[model samples]
Target: MSNRSIGLDGPLYDYLLEHSLREPEILAELRAETANLPEANMQIAPEQGQFMALLARLMGARRYLEIGTFTGYSALAIALALPEDGTVVTLDKSAQWTTTARRYWERAGVSGRIRLELGEAGNTLQALEAEGETSRFDLAFIDADKTGYPDYFEHCLRLVRAGGLILVDNTLWHGSVADPDDTREDTRAIRAFNDALHHDERIDLSLAPIGDGLTLARRR
Candidate 1:
């Protein structure tokens, strides 16, 4: 049976975001800018951002990778948690979307910390691997196209160090993963990925019912 559970609703999610997330002035501005975007819902909740930041800090992550940078919210969150010398490599295919991301990243004063790679995510990952980046990253977050999730997972597994963490977003696919009737390609892909990871010995995995669901895999 599927292990996914119901996620946050109106009051609780709002309360959590309000209480736990402390957005800096620049980040607030970035959020406002992102609010008008068509894919604004793709932005991670403020609480989720705080969670990622805390995880990065706890793991002492210096080198980070993000497969999808919508408006740079998650990247900024993780960047804020990193030390002075830390850096993040963020990838996205759309120059149009990344324009917004670049602006926010610059506004957050984290442009220096982030290297935005504009192109196909798979090719970028392959290039990074070829550049001797395999097993070098400290943390990786995959939140791009749902259909490319498995590829992203494989590449991230290769790029993240043995003890690194891989955070896969939208693992629940908005409750579709549990409904056998809903066999859309995206849901099927996520289901396959989740099943494969559940039995994989390379990582210690846990699927949390956070916003849309987040799968945390710590490389073993």
Candidate 2:
């Protein structure tokens, strides 16, 4: 079997976006603004955001949860996809970055649908659990620090309803996870997380070869 794909090599990816991407003006503006940041790479690719939004819509997700909220592009996409009654609870520790996020959410007029929490994700997750939020979310997206991926998945698994979906970002770690000599902390953690998910029976799994790699786990 060959892993080679024409899209990764050249114009195919650009064509994919040209024909398929229907980014709202607000989202385009947000993406453009985020592109200037020093940590801009942290943003998920636009196509990936669109993909996740379609998934949320397909699953009829009414309650959404996001573990990482960098500039809020992903949240905005999900919020737009959800119905008026849908809600998204997103967690992030960066007040500075999330301030940018909040501005965009307000611009998109989805601020009311999204609740932003500023603190350690673990603390927030535990708090949600204590508030009887078990199985409360219809979908959860884990894009936080890679070291916390394992714990985040555990919490999201419990917070999201049975049969709900969990999306984990950067599972491929920019192709570094396939290189044994990398030995980076983030890479190792992602590798372990991927291995664990592959064996875990609580969910069905598929690691998609999308931007930076996205792993989909559906609770049983």
lDDT of 1 by residue, 130-219 (tens): 999999899999999988988899999999999999999999888899999998989999999899999999999999877788899999
Candidate 2 achieves a global lDDT of: 0.95
Candidate 2 lDDT, 1-220, residue by residue in tens:
6667433755888888999999999999999999999999999999999999999999999999999999999999999999999999999999999999999999899999999999999999999999999999999999989999999999999999999999999998989999999998989999999999999999999999899999999999
Model 1, residue 41: distance off in Å is 1.8
Alpha-carbon runs more than 4 Å astray in model 2: 1-7
* TM-score to native of every candidate shown: 0.94, 0.97
Residue 95: error of model 1 in Å?
0.7
Q: What would the TM-score be for candidate 1 when compared with the true structure? A: 0.94
| Candidate lDDT (C-alpha), each | 0.89, 0.95
